[model samples]
Target: MELLLVEDDERVSRFVRRGLEAEGYSVTAAQDGVAGLSRARAESYDVLILDVMLPGLSGRDVCRQLRKAEVSTPILMLTALDHTDDKVECLRGGADDYLTKPFDFEELLARLEALARRGRGFSSEPPAVLEVGNVRIDRQSMRVLLDGEPVELTAKEYQLLDLLLSSPGRVFSRTRILNKVWGYDSDPLTNVVDVYIRRLRGKMRWDRDTGWIRTIRSYGYRLDPTI
Candidate 1:
């Protein structure tokens, strides 16, 4: 995932950038709130980590401005303040989450993952590669392969596959899939899902022993890793 970190604290920013990069994320960092806000407005990122205290502008103001500009990216505020009021203020200013200084890196990572997944039906964290059975998907390159053989897919097909692979076995209802993947709710007259499912199965060469996309009768579909 592409992330923008807005922090004036050099030590903190470097720490986060290094950690996230090691975990396969593309990170761009800004040192001050104004610069950070400018970058956020001019570019698209999967997530933003903003420090509460910064030169020129406060993280709260940056978040508020981003929201005003209709930028829906998730914002995680980093603050040394630990009061309940501080947390409330961050949320009130349109921040999605906040981390107290001296916080556990693991916890911060978890929160980042959670915030990043808010609108997308992806794995909690941004993943470079996803694997199920012999099927492998390289998220960075948007390539799919089965047992080392490349598989070509249409744009929509690839998106559907990516959603399923995001969380194996997380049963996604037809309506949910329709909204998430198709960008709309399900319609009784539409058989688009069936058509895509059939296409996916055929393209993936699914068989009884390798049926990764399992139909949960009367409900929806799930990626069965066991299959």
Candidate 2:
């Protein structure tokens, strides 16, 4: 797989590049945001490893521009900013995943593999239809099936469901959800996420007797595993 590694730290860049290359991925390294964004727009890559800080333009900006340009390449953001706000910002900015500094290489590789699999529209295990009770999620077509029937969802709803179903049983805070489904630096007070989640639940549970999206009171929400 072709991978783009955008980082300014020379030592960290070299270390990660060698590790990924050793694992059989063709690695391209860019030391600054401008060069990284240029390479990203110029070529097709399977995944991007972007550092939050760069010489010109932030990684967040690069991610936003890539998404704006409709590049579907999976992005994994790397940074020393471990604050929840920072992580949320990156996700909202268009990153698929976030990793703090001093991370384990093994975990990073695993996350990259997962992102690759998702990008290729394949899961590691057998391809079984995903169902949350009566609601079915068609991974192949990015469509929702309810009661064996198709249910229409807006773009935002689809994205919200995708995020929740991708990591079921994991409680995602409002901030994190905002980043993942919206974009980084979105208005934190906006009820857009809640509205979309309610809409999704309304459609998904229309024919079912139970709810799939469970609210965690003040924390956030999560997909109930038992559903």
Candidate 3:
């Protein structure tokens, strides 16, 4: 997934860009709010990570402008402030999710994933059926079967699987997955995608027994090639 990260701190920006790239995401960084806004307006992105305190424009202002301009890309707001009013202000300004500094990378990734899912209009209601390779996901009843046997999956695991199956062979960056699955705005230092990929492999990819959900290696993930 393509993402725009608007942050002023060079150190923070580099750290985040590296982390997101490691998770196989394509990220564009803007040093301040003005440049960030310009980049956002100039291109299409799956998500935006905006810092509350910006040089040219505040994160809140950027969100406000985006909303005013009818840019529907999901936004995750970042800030060091943890006050309730501050959170409210950002949300009111149009941020989908808010995060304070010193956050758990895992939690941030989860939030970002959740947001992406929401943006894609994924149904909370279970699906009737999901088929990927020899595995089948029954959304209506929240059941998964591999090789005709029941397979256990955690809630997050099921969500991730459903996401992959829904878009077979489409590359999904770590940031994209994080927003769609976890509902957060940004995570610059998390290896959450790798962690979850490992978990999914353990559960779904049984050696050569199952061959779905291939990693693109430094890009993201895709479902079985056949879609």
**What TM-score does candidate 2 reach?**
0.56
TM-score of each candidate structure, all chains considered together: 0.57, 0.56, 0.66
TM-score of 1: 0.57
lDDT string, candidate 3, 129-151, tens digits: 97777778888888998779998
Better of 1 and 2 by TM-score: 1
Which stretches of model 1 miss by more than 4 angstroms?
A: 121-227
Q: Is candidate 1 or candidate 2 better by lDDT?
A: 1
User: Pick by TM-score: which candidate is best?
Assistant: 3
lDDT of 3 at 200: 82
As for TM-score, the candidate ahead, 2 or 3, is 3
lDDT of 2 by residue, 1-227 (tens): 89999999999999999877655579999999999999999999999999999989889999999999999999999999889999988889889999999897767877998999989988688444566666677777877876778888888888788778766776767766777677653475788777887888787763223567788777578787554
* Model 1 local distance difference test score: 0.85
In angstroms, give how far residue 48 of model 1 lies from its true place.
0.7
